[model samples]
Target: MRNTLLVLLFMAVNTISYSQNQFTGIVKDAENGEPVFSANVYFPTLEKGDITGEDGRFEIGNLPAGNYKLVISSIGYTSYTTEINIPAEEFEILLTPSAIEMEEVIVSTPFHQLQSENVMKVERESISELNKNGAVTLSDGITQIAGVESVTTGTGIGKPVIRGLSSNRVLVYTQGIRLENQQYGEEHGLGISSMGIGSVEVIKGPASLLYGSDAIGGVLYLNPELYASSGETNGELRTDYFTNTRGYQSSLMAKTSGEKLKFLARGSIAAHSDYKTGNYERVTNTRFSEKDLKAGIGFQDQKYKADLRYNFNRSEIGIPEEIGIQSTRKLPLLPNQVIDNHVLSLDNKFYFKNSSLDFRVGYQFNDRKEFEEHHEHEEDHEEGEEHEEEHETHEEDEDHEHEHEEHEGPALEMHLETLNYNLKYNLPKIGNFEIITGVQGMYQTNDNFGEEILIPNAETFDFGIYTTAHYHISNWDFQGGLRFDHRDLQTEQTLSEGQLIEGIDRSFNSVNGAFGVKYKFGEKFTGRLNLASGFRAPNLSELTSYGTHHGANRFEIGNPDLDNEQNFQVDLALEYRNQHFEVFANAFRNSISNYIFINPTGEEIDGEAVFEYDQQNAMLYGGEAGIHIHPHPLDWLHLESSFQTVTGELENGGYLPLIPANSLTNTFRVELENIGRNLVSSYSFIRLRSVFDQNNPGSFETETPGYSLLSAGIGTGVKLDEFMLDLRLSGNNLLNESYISHLSRLKPDGIQNIGRNIMLSATISL
Candidate 1:
């Protein structure tokens, strides 16, 4: 039955009628009035796109008679999008130089358009800007975005929290594929590194209509670096240093592009010692080191395009323990972890006479292992005497003794493999509407080879189908979509010493949808309203786990009869902008049915508290507001401030766990000129951030006090004839204020946050 339906869908997508309305355009640079060659020109409604030739001209011959959304973009330039009528005369499009916050190209949505043209708003940040914040990890840098926070175990490991949701509820995409790295655990951090990435795109609300399951909270999209300009080759070397942890990082990248082919490569390495707290004391076993490499090759022509890429990451991270003595060690002691991740993907785009299609496939492998120290009882022995020699070597002598005596191997090891596939088609223009239909899925398996087991071996399969559309009118944009998904999971019955542990087979299905509209009130104001539904299937750890959680120091038991979680949310946003000032606000409310969470039972298992996974009805609501001002007399002086807050509560009265505290931040910046020879565009800024006390406590949760931090930074760029150099110096937590974050996993132990530290970074490009 499924095969028959798929065949019909393919047949409908391939059937198209050609048209005769031709549209021609020329692209040029706005600053210098020069032709911009190799620029991209596209029409989303017509499903037609092409790249400019040497003369910066492109012609699409088969566009139907209708209103279309046309976009033109090039490297190092802001994207331009406008509504146009078919059968029109030739037009000219001008591209401006990229600014600090340029108009971004929206991904994760079916249609590609500029942020202003998109019906649903998205948050974007450049990699260069994130680096300037003195962030040591990708997860840490993203916290700078309003309404976003990070749950940290230490300086080296953390996870992203969107509003009041995190862990498996949040989804991450890299290399155009979902990342799977056993993320349900409190100690598991995001596996991908920030090196070689171009930018980050975030959808702060549910996006299940496009991304399917596990997108109940939000989506974090990482875009890879763009290919070099036609017939261009470039290379860069970057390095950074951190004073608090005595850490260093370095990376190198090279890329080249030709008329029909392109290639790129990047490699990076980072190492850090144990971090120091605000009290001037070192936290034991908090050090970590990482190595990452990425490479890609691509080929494109008039009708076809294909790209292949690969990424590899390895990390050696230490697990903190209160029993260990304080010391500034560069390597972990006894209990530590070694993890490696590899990903390979292939993306292909095919263009027909009046339509286009895209197909992507990816494979990922993750290997994780944990090592623990083995204790031995004291025994009296003669000096230099050997009393451990066996008289006769038996078949199981060494193996039996090692298991019962002193063992020297990994305490737990797990290997995970996943394969993903996606197929999407854009239908030809029909009136003033553009429609997209697609299918996406994944097949995965997990296996363990260790004495201690956390989750049983399991196999998971998922499938989803969706259809989305966009309509553009005079001053209004409309978007809506519907999606259906199903997930099937099976686990082998666990057995230990002739005792049964857990086994399960279950299937979950859901139907979700979204509708949104954006209206331009005038040239200086805009408004948007969106309503969406999302769902999430239970993860392996939440359904079959049965072990001791070393990081939380507790016993965890999973419920096999758990059901899927469903959510519905409404988002409203408003913005007002002009030459001197800009302000924006976003408000949202989300209600969930059958929300899954772990709760303490007031019971003990083997001298540790027992926590069980359970379901409950919950609600969350929040809002974020910000403003930016640049004085008229002092154009170079800039001021910005923002506030974010969220409240989560169960249906009855109790609050939810792991909710972030409200925060407010203010910044003052000024531009400088004539600093030195060959130097231009020098700038500096001072920032203050205050976190409010978390008084709304959940069951078994405690209240946390508030704290304030002050920071500052300065940076500049220098031009050499054939080489360019960039330098920055930043001071974080300059006040060295002692504080504990409510979302920190180590808060129970009274571990203070990082101390005052200095950071330096430099980049040389050729």
Candidate 2:
């Protein structure tokens, strides 16, 4: 890893002759041919972009000689996207004036098409937009999107659930590489921070054809922040304060871009005290603190481009049991977790006139430690004991050993390391057909370091190969793909004073495929149909665990004979849009064979309930529908409503565990182009969120009642001389509702979620 880092740094500093190719264009309004100033013109593939000048002219120099997708966008006007060849003649681009939101390129899927042109129905959200909606964390923000939910242990730890599946089922990608950080654990949160993230794209259904195993449920793709434009240097400072947790977050970012090299760095820190409930009672030991640093460097020439990104994150989070303490403490107490993660990724692209090759590699190291309250055992010695000298010597040795054991080491510790690589080749376009073939895989190893072990030391190896294609004909788009994956798992045998365990070696193979069609019905309606298959191999814990998992408060037993889980899903989506209104609906039904889950055995081990891994057939169905309205005459006023629901059931009977309740959300918003003399833009919004009752509980699970929450926020951008400042004030749970989420791990203890929270944030651009 050290050698690789040095090589990457050397490449970033080395320079070559610049290419003479340059692209220039002018952006104008379609209605009156008026120049559109300050419009963003970008090439997603090259990681290069330019802003239109006052005269609407933009120039991008030193571009590789190849075909690239060009996107031009500005506020209050429809975005323009098209395929353009480098070194082509200068041209004029016209954008239509519209009230609808501008479309962004979808990076999760192949072809990198806009959502409107994608065959798959993907949800995309920007970090800035999520923050404006009063989201406290990246996971909390994603719940605002339809068809998505989270299994939360607290505000600091959350596992994303897509369409009722979570844990090892959903795969997360960052910086163009797979993120492998012990995701099999439900208490593990998404380690990637939102500080340097530009946006997030979600693939809601089976994506095995694109990602491989573990993507049977879906995928979360996080795009990193873009580098500064050529010859530009920029800096930003952002800060936020929250009332409920007495939490504060701050970040500093700086970037500079040369003609051939670009570099960026960001540092962020956050700390929060125990959160309070609606009754103003603090949840003891729920405090958390985080520190993060992200950096990136990129170098490009005529034929090749390379980008290297690195992130290091450290977090200390407390585990709340019964809410005993009432003080606002920022540091976590015993029964807490300390985690450190390091992620490094390097992406390289080779451009060849009509085709391109992309190679990406990533390395991740995760160190997780859990500390539990310690108790000392007392031994009594009789006054008139025989062999007094021997007894004294034994007691002295025992005391020394006890002293060493009391040195404050973690009760449980694990180190996970992963190395993954991806290679894709874009074939030359044949008429209207475009195809891409890729190979993706990873090698991982997990080691135990502490006194307690939830899972034995194990090694995993994965290899996959896939091919996908896209074709455009008339008003219809067709896409299909096929993939094959193989995984190998091996564990070491261990023998203890009271227990004997045998090691096992297992191998699994799977073949998956996906097909989809998208059609445009005239100018206002669009429809899509998709069918896909996916699979996931059993994780280490599911195959070798034999002890208690303190994080979940249960003793678990693994099943080494578990089979691979395979699933098939069918999805349908429809959309209607016009000058005043936009509506969309998405539906999906999934069937799985050999679905794996943990079942209570009605047994106890050492005072803890025992659970064992089991497998059964299951089915899941869900849909999401939403509408946005901007009255023609009152474009500043907007009304939006959305509803999402999903149900999961075992083949024999009962419902699946951790399923999210049906939810509905409505928002009323008003936008002002200019609020005052210094305020250039402003917006305010109020939202009502409702969760319906969840009576369909799985085995050992109880029913949960529904609840409603009210929230509102206002934000504005202020212009001061040549600098820009953004300010926002938001409140969540304004009604102070005392409610518990169906997927909350703390719900069984009758603990309510965080109550009314007021947040104030500001960002200054220099």
Candidate 3:
């Protein structure tokens, strides 16, 4: 009789476990009792999801038995979120209609939370939304967000500047890993493609508590395109054309997903000729081209999920000089760069009864080459003529000939390889408190293989450990984290211009922390206050460089005794939102110790101005404010306005260099849904931007005049039987404004920014 009881108990346990693996839910409109079809029901932590069918029913199976956060979202409705336990009764979700934009998940933070619930005020924008604003490139698109700007060399090269800091201060992440492409140089571009990117999240302040070194200023996190819904297959083809540069862009993407397996692939190519300025003069050697490919595969079961992704990109960018040539050539001329990059990453997650573990590993390889025009000197020819008689009788001349052949090739070539990993454990939630602990590290190497070496060959190793927690009580949320990091850098001595440059080995350590609080006032107001500290170790160029940077037209000298840069920043944000109106303001103050910068030494080397790296204490303060309005009855109309300002100064006396001028933007937009039988949606918009004069210039910089620009765009989506077509027409600098941006690298040469450019784009979905 005892044996019989044991068998019955085991059978009951198995039945319970099987029942807990599946869940069902139904979605309906809150106002009416009608089903809401195509609503997305997802469990983010579990990596499990399903879409509601026509009858508003969704069922997800093969889930581990645990308490999970359930989210139900649909267009034109407010998203619903709640905590659910396995084996619970069926859920009936009611969604309320809303005119405001839907909230998105913030992935850059340790805890993935909705934007409305996050302690930090992160800015997020979709790639499609940026493209609709007539952005010519990814770096250009980010400038549309307040408190963000770009240092542009020309139409082909740009670097992102957050607040008033740039270069190695800001960190960029893609494919779940930090991007390393020798970002210390001002002439280097972002080295990222816009195709296959879903959205971008910007952390406006110090994020070293989450991402260790090099995040003293901020971070830019890019999210890849998601897989298709389960049991669905989709494909798309897109094309774009620009008039100012005679540019062409084309891309293709396909994705398929099953219950346990998913796959996606995308390929894109872009080419452009020299861009014309407002005066109809084309800048010489400003053309550029790019090719990119992205692929990903994922698998998930009851307790584990794994995803693997790969990206390959190649770019050919021209180094713009004086306005000399007028040809509309697609290929870049001499004094250009060729860069190839490859990235691979693997992400894995394991689920337990009440907790989870995540492991991610990424590898990246970058190959860069620069080609410059080779000039022959008359003295060298005369010497060669004298040696011609001896060359015919000596075998050493053959070696000299081979050396000459090599010198005709690329002037600079460098290879960089990086490997990084992250392991995080999410502790089981205790009531309304959650915690996570993680370890992150990276190993990288840089090698030079050309005639010119901008930086000596070096290797670097990094390790960091951190823990973060979040607590919720009443209408308040609190978050804080602490991190410790260590780095070891080693370099090989080399010769530059017959000088023996000494090599060095060094190690650095740092400890950083962050704390933030969010409070809700009534139902329409929210406030956030955050304090964070960050640090950055000096990079290779700052420590070892001793060469002329042809791209920047300057000779650089490095300082090997530079110390680590540390900073502290305090940020405050206030937001008020309702059904028809929204307003937000963000303010921040940052103070830094050992702030590094470049200054002219009043010397010349190889016909280039000499500059040396130095450090001092600095301070920067900025604020951004924006407002959105949509009248009660005129919900289709939107009026938006925003203003951004920042100022930087050295503690000793002078203003900081490269600070963007204050700017204001105003936009008017109209949107319509389902205008006709074949028309799915349509939108039209016009925007005006004004930049205030920058009278307070750095000691070594010149002042810039103020300017204004106008832009307009129109777009529509059409349904044709089994396919959907999207079309857009946009124009930038519509009034042909002749002005130079304060951050333009070519401003000293009296070069005007691109103007009067029109773009047409089309996409077909199947």
Candidate 4:
């Protein structure tokens, strides 16, 4: 690993070249004069590049002293290309918006724009951000956003969690289309990758107002390559090699566009051997490898644009089980898992004189195969490796592995399909008003069950219609939405002590909505209020699942008679921003009626440990506050800080699992540019983060402790006439502080986190 880092660092310093003549200008909205940020300014053949800033200013620093064709493009805008000469001084250029006689453009302010009351945008480094495991995942990108967390099984598998919900509570939309798969498994991380993403936006609260169910926790939007104003093309090639895990990851993406059409394609592959925790102990018992592929085609003249996309992924992992004692230590034996998933989607958009429309339809299929056998497994408790001593002693005293039965795997198959339609109209005749409406339908079929306990093949169908309207009167923007859903669920579960008995039937219908208002306080601050309602039907797997999940080492059970859960939420946010500073504070409280819950009773039914699912009245509530500072004070330094806390409990005072409590993150950034005139250099940032102990009450499982983790990184980029390069070296847990995260099942009794590690990554544009 150390040698790999040295090599990457050497490459960073070796890739320097002479300069080229430069052309520079600022691009803004023709109507509003708002700067178009991060607009791609490119010369494709030369592989040269520049990006517009927050002020919409772009400058190609080194132009190889010549007349060159330049292309520029931005989303929701027209493309422009022309020939220009790079003299000594920067020149100002203006471009016009694409004209197709379409509706009033609703400009998406970078990342959540922070421009409008109805929409919130967050812009930051997603593709460039690395994870604790040293390799980046889309899931890692979401950690920076408030009200977001990951249900991680290991460094390789982290599922997004919104609000106080995970699993089906949150929805993922990539390129304006929904993604569905059987993600309940531990290794489902293989299902998606962040290869070519430009940015990620998270809607932190109830969003049934627009996206329908599953938005209960919120929504994650992963957008593709942002187009430049010119008619050229865009692309990137990034390769990351990690030392601690002894693996490599590579990604490549490309896109091309003309006046009427745009197309994009990307592929990625990551492979790693087992990684070690602190010391020389290998925490991961599996050797894992994953591959991802995605392609998209889009068509547009002026009034309409349609997109078709397909994604495929596959992974294989060794599921190691301890079967015997090797001198008082449990010995790991060969056991394995194989998983594969495929998704295909189509989305269409149309723009008229005063309205914009989007339609989405998709299907996803998955097949998982698993194998496991005799092993005595116990949780390590949400604490570090303090339990290793006990594990070693027990192995020496008892015959733990040879007595258990060999666990056989199952044949798993699932298919889910969704069809959706949405339209937003900016009613010019109705003054300042925008109305958004949509309807979505989904049908899913699955054959997932155990031989002893059969949950017959089942199918579910759901349809929903929703509408949202934004009305602005003076400084106040009032927004509200209403949604209605009809659901039909058929569960096939045979009840038989001997002969087969027919399965039962069930169904449900629900209504959800939200009302919100934002009051602008001058140009620097805004206060917003939202009152929302959300509902979730019991998922097929949640209702009919029955089996053993060896990853967590626990027998599982499910109930088919569970009812739907409904919730009411109230949230308030205050935001202030200006040229060099930004501050945001948010608060919310949610009350759930008929909350569905799973309980483990330390009791076993027959030979399998029986866990039951039931409904109860519960209350979930929490809030977060953030403050950022990027003052012009030094021109060479920047700092930012944020804090968040949350808590929840059952009606009977039982504590909810996995509630994040009081956390803090602080970051400092400094840079130096225009070095020796030919070079622009910068040192990005250093961050400190920590999480407090979880003491929210009822948890028979275990508890999590407060621990502090330190991380630091530095990077530099070089620009040549036709080539550019970037490099970064990062380290985490420098103190080797031992701690356990709440979501880690192994932290309760298995292996702890990897102690200390460093990584270096590089990107090259050809």
Clashes per prediction? 0, 0, 0, 32
Task: lDDT for model 1, please.
Answer: 0.82
In order of appearance, the predictions have TM-scores of 0.88, 0.93, 0.93, 0.78
Cα lDDT tens digits for candidate 4, 1-766? 8368446644643463334445678888776788887676765323345678889998654344444446666643555555564454664545555311112111222111123334332223345544422434566557766677776654556677766677777777765656666555434553677776665666777777666666776777776655432366767688877655666778887878665566878899987655555554555343466788888876653344567877777765545332122121222223444567777777655433334445566777765554444353544431323444544555333323422322344333333444433333322214566566667767776664433442347677778887767677878877787889877877664553353434546777788878877888997788888888888777765676565545545555666678777888888888887656678888888887877667776787446555666778887777778777755656556677888777778898777776665789887877655455335465767778878887773454566678777878787777766666777777766676666677654555555555666777777664
Q: Is candidate 1 or candidate 4 better by lDDT?
A: 1
lDDT of each: 0.82, 0.87, 0.88, 0.61
Q: How many clashes does the backbone of model 2 have? A: 0
lDDT of prediction 2: 0.87
Better of 3 and 4 by TM-score: 3
Q: Which ten residues in a row have the lowest lDDT in candidate 4?
A: 104-113
In candidate 4, residue 617 scores what lDDT?
Answer: 84
Q: Residue-wise lDDT of candidate 1 within 213-266, one digit each (tens)?
A: 989999988888877755778899999999999898899999998866889999
lDDT of residue 729 for candidate 4: 76
- What number of backbone clashes does candidate 1 have, counting pairs of residues 3 or more apart or in separate chains? 0
lDDT of 1 at 761: 94
TM-score of 1: 0.88
Please give the range of 10 consecutive residues that has the lowest summed lDDT in model 1: 382-391
Tell me how far candidate 2 lies from the true structure as C-alpha RMSD in angstroms: 7.1
